[model samples]
Target chain A: MVTLIQRILRGNPTLFFVYVILFVFFVFAASTAPQFRTVYNISNLLRQAVAFGIVGIGQTIVILSGGIDLSVGSLISLAACLTSGIMIGNPTLVFPIVFLVLGIGVLVGLTNGTLVAYLRVPPFIATLAMSAILQGSVLLYTKKPVGGVTRGFMFFANGQLGAIPFAFVFWVILLSFFLFLLRRTGLGLHVYAIGGNQEIARLSGIRVSVAKVAVYVISGFMAALTGLFLASRLGIGDPLMGQGFELESITAVLIGGTSLAGGKGGIEGTIAGVLIIALINNILNLLGVSGFWQWIIKGIVVIVVVAAYKVKE
Target chain B: MLVALFVVAGIVSPIFYRPQNIFNVLQQASALGVVSVGQTLVILSGGIDLSIASIMATSCVFAAALMAGKNSMVIPITLFCLAIGALAGFLNGIITTRRNAPPFIVTLGTALIFQGIRFVYTKGAPFGSIPSWLRFLGRGGIGFVPASVIIFLFLALVMEAILQRSAYGRKIYAVGDNKVAALYSGINVPNIILSVYALSGIFAAFGGLVLAGYLGFGDNWAGKGYELDAIAAVVVGGTSLAGGEGGMGGTVVGVLLITILSNIVLLAGLPYQFQQIVKGLVVAAAVIFYSFVKVSGERR
Candidate 1:
């Protein structure tokens, strides 16, 4: 048993850290916040994690490909603004609006991917600029809160089958799909290969540029999905709905054990990281900790997690 | 590019060179100039500091909380703010160097933590008055020159000298260009990295103090978006983001250009949103242009 535990840590230190922190956080929450382990609160926590977890999955992909996307949050905002403005509670407009929002995501992801892969712009600057552009565009779209989410659309977020939230179900499906893709597919192999060494991967004929673009497109899709669900959940279009999710998602990815340098993480780690964050957020809320200290604690977590990873390395 | 911008601005709005407007530009550039110098050093070391704006905000908040409008408290408050900034930077530096964490993530984390602490301390709205003398530093001028501008000039000169002539300057470049090579040459690479982050933190605090003085009030969000502005200046100044290939001279030019561009945008009567879009595009253009130039130069 000792050897197995030692081997597990040796093989995947990130997993060890994530799960250990997650368990400890759970225990702490259970001990400190009486309502924290209640079923309703647990459901609410899972729901809260869904949007970010989806975006975190996208971030996981981008990071795995040796790139980072700072535009996810803005992308989420843009998606929410556009879809909410266009849908306006019309059941007929739902399909078209969703498609259009997802299409915008594609265009954005392509722009970022092209800049990085073809024009050789650094991923950080490219995505950061993209973020600014998206933010600006959202502002231009509307300065006021947009409303008109149809009951059907709201159901996507609020409706649950049996004991499960629809959003959680969506999250699970996306998670399983990505997990399968990452662990059992040729595309996944290429992603890891490219991140491991682009030059070598390119020499080995792995279509590095295409893979890079594809990953960003996936990330964009995920951000859009998150935004769409967020708008529906709120039942109104908020231009700032996903204002800080980019950092949060990235934090989740990093905490999940993904390397910023790329090619060294997976979805499971990201989910663990997300759950841990959500749980802590839940506990903090239960404890009535002010929002300011929450920010401080989160920042500390990101740094400490990364530092731990660095030390382990 | 600087000259071209000046020429264009002159063509479009001769007011761009009006003495008062020029002073305004210089004054505006002054705050950014201080921040960019620190940014230049960090970029030179092949790392970036996203926490700069937060550090500035934290310093401003601390100054407000400590000085409480007392003239005599100014010196002590300022010193305390600088110390806090250095401490924040020290945390950043130690984690980044010892743990081998990427600078971007480390700084981003620090930025959030600091911003959060300031918000918690101030409860979202910061309140306090600046000391009269410090306000003079931010808003007052000595003999027709803004004191802030003069401070900026002095800082520019000193930092330029350090970057161009000092042994430590050479070490910074060496460490940035290749850490392993520097280590092989027996330089303390981690120490250099730590010092750069610390210096950046100190300057960010200094910039925050000036900004607070200029505004004559404490604002938790005073330093919002300044990080990008500083970065834009550094990039425009021709400092390679990849590190080891730029200096304060170019950053000064960059700061002037950015200040001028924003001034023009404002004068053009565009909404604030467009200003952001333009800045984003300008950064993208400058980065692409630099890469293109580097590529063609290499090929030749």
Candidate 2:
């Protein structure tokens, strides 16, 4: 037991620190707030984290690849609106719409990838433009909430598997798959190499453009999945649903010890980061703190946490 | 390119040539134009200020709440707002430089904090109005040209001259071009970066003041999307995002182009959504076009 504990402590100090913080906060919240300790609220907290976690995974990949995607939030809005608009409460149309939305997500990602890789556009500018385009398109499609999903279609987010929410379960599967890919696959190594030093990576014969493009596609696909989950949970397509998510996801990734400079972090820290945010949000809500204060707290936390990492370095 | 856009706009709408419409576009351009000037400095120094919009909003609200449409309160409040803007930028600069954190994330975090402050201060319902003198800055004109336009053009020319001739401006370029080299050359890189951010904050605040005066009221969402717009304008104008390679002259043209494009869209009676789409396409296209020109120039 001592050796096992020591191994974890030595393996990834950042990850251990994050989990420790999450645990301490969790215990503090549970002790202080009776509602927070309840199984119902705990499960609800997990549900709330699902959307952020899903998009955060994609953000992690992009950041790991030394790029950022400002378009995920807009893409989520588009996906949600498109999913419900096409479904329109029809159970029969669910699968087709899901596929369609996911396809569009991939297409958008491909465009971003091409711009960043082939055209050599800065990821910041490329993604920002893509975000604007997506946002405008969504608004043109519908300024307000439009269309609804059938009750049966809600299972994507609301269903239960044993004691676990389906969305949570889905998130775990994704987390595991990405973990395996990053830890075990050649593509993952290439991602790190590209991020660490693009010129060197190119000299080493790594398919730099392909890897860059792939990360964006992965980000896009995950954002679409988040959109689907959100649509299912809400039962309607909201044009404004995905607001603030791009920054929020980046916040999670940064807090998780993922360096914005790239090639130095993992998805495991991201999960803890997502949990920490959800926990704070839940705790603050239980404490009757207004959302405005929450925003202030969140902003401070991001700076303080990143600064702490810098201090450690 | 500016002339081409003008020709196209005139062809699309006969009213585009009207002096009244031209001045209207210039007046509308002033706020964003001012904000873009700040963004240009930061970008030139190899940093981005995502917090500018929030700073702008905070300035707008703070000015309105303090001035409260009183002519007597204008000078002090305006100075106070600019100081506050500088302080906010100083905070951004401190964290980003000292911690070596990405300006993108740091400024983003600061943006939220600033936005939260605005919300908490106003309690979600901001009240107050601009004074008439300040209103002249935003909406009033000297004959055909708007006062705001005059301020914008003057600022642009001064900034351009500074970029070309001033040692401080040259230091900004050196830091942006190569921080390590600049440091080796005995430049106080951090101080330069810090000062640049502070300048950005002041400019953003000034932009906010203009916006408030034009609107005649305090609004929570007044500067909602100006950060991106300013960035778009600066980059579209031909300032390289890579830093140290572009200048105020290009940014001025960029601001004008963006404002005119939007004006055309409005004049053509297209939906606001189309304006957004076109804006996105233009940013992307402009970047692409600039890079293409650069690549060809390099090859030659």
TM-scores of all models?
Answer: 0.96, 0.98
User: What is the C-alpha lDDT profile of model 1 across B182-204, one tens digit per residue?
Assistant: 89999999999999999999999
Largest TM-score belongs to which candidate?
2
Candidate 1's DockQ: 0.63
After TM-score superposition, the amount by which residue B34's alpha carbon in candidate 2 deviates from its true location, in angstroms, is: 0.8
lDDT of 1 at B202: 95
Taking the tens digit of each residue's C-alpha lDDT, what string does model 1 give over A1-313?
Answer: 9999899999998798789989998899888888987888988899899978989999999999999999998899889888889888889999999889889888888888988988888888888888887888898888877867898999888888899888899899999999999889988989898988899999998999999999888898889988888888888878888877888898888888887777888998999989988888888899898888999998998888888776333
Interface RMSD of each: 2.0, 2.6
Q: What is the C-alpha lDDT profile of model 2 across B66-95, one tens digit per residue?
A: 899999999999999899889889988999
Name every residue pair that clashes in candidate 2.
Answer: none
Candidate 1 at residue B180, lDDT? 87
Top DockQ model: 1
DockQ of 2: 0.60
Candidate 2: list runs displaced more than 4 Å: A311-313
Model 1: lDDT of residue A216: 88
- Interface DockQ per candidate: 0.63, 0.60
All models, RMSD in angstroms: 2.0, 1.5
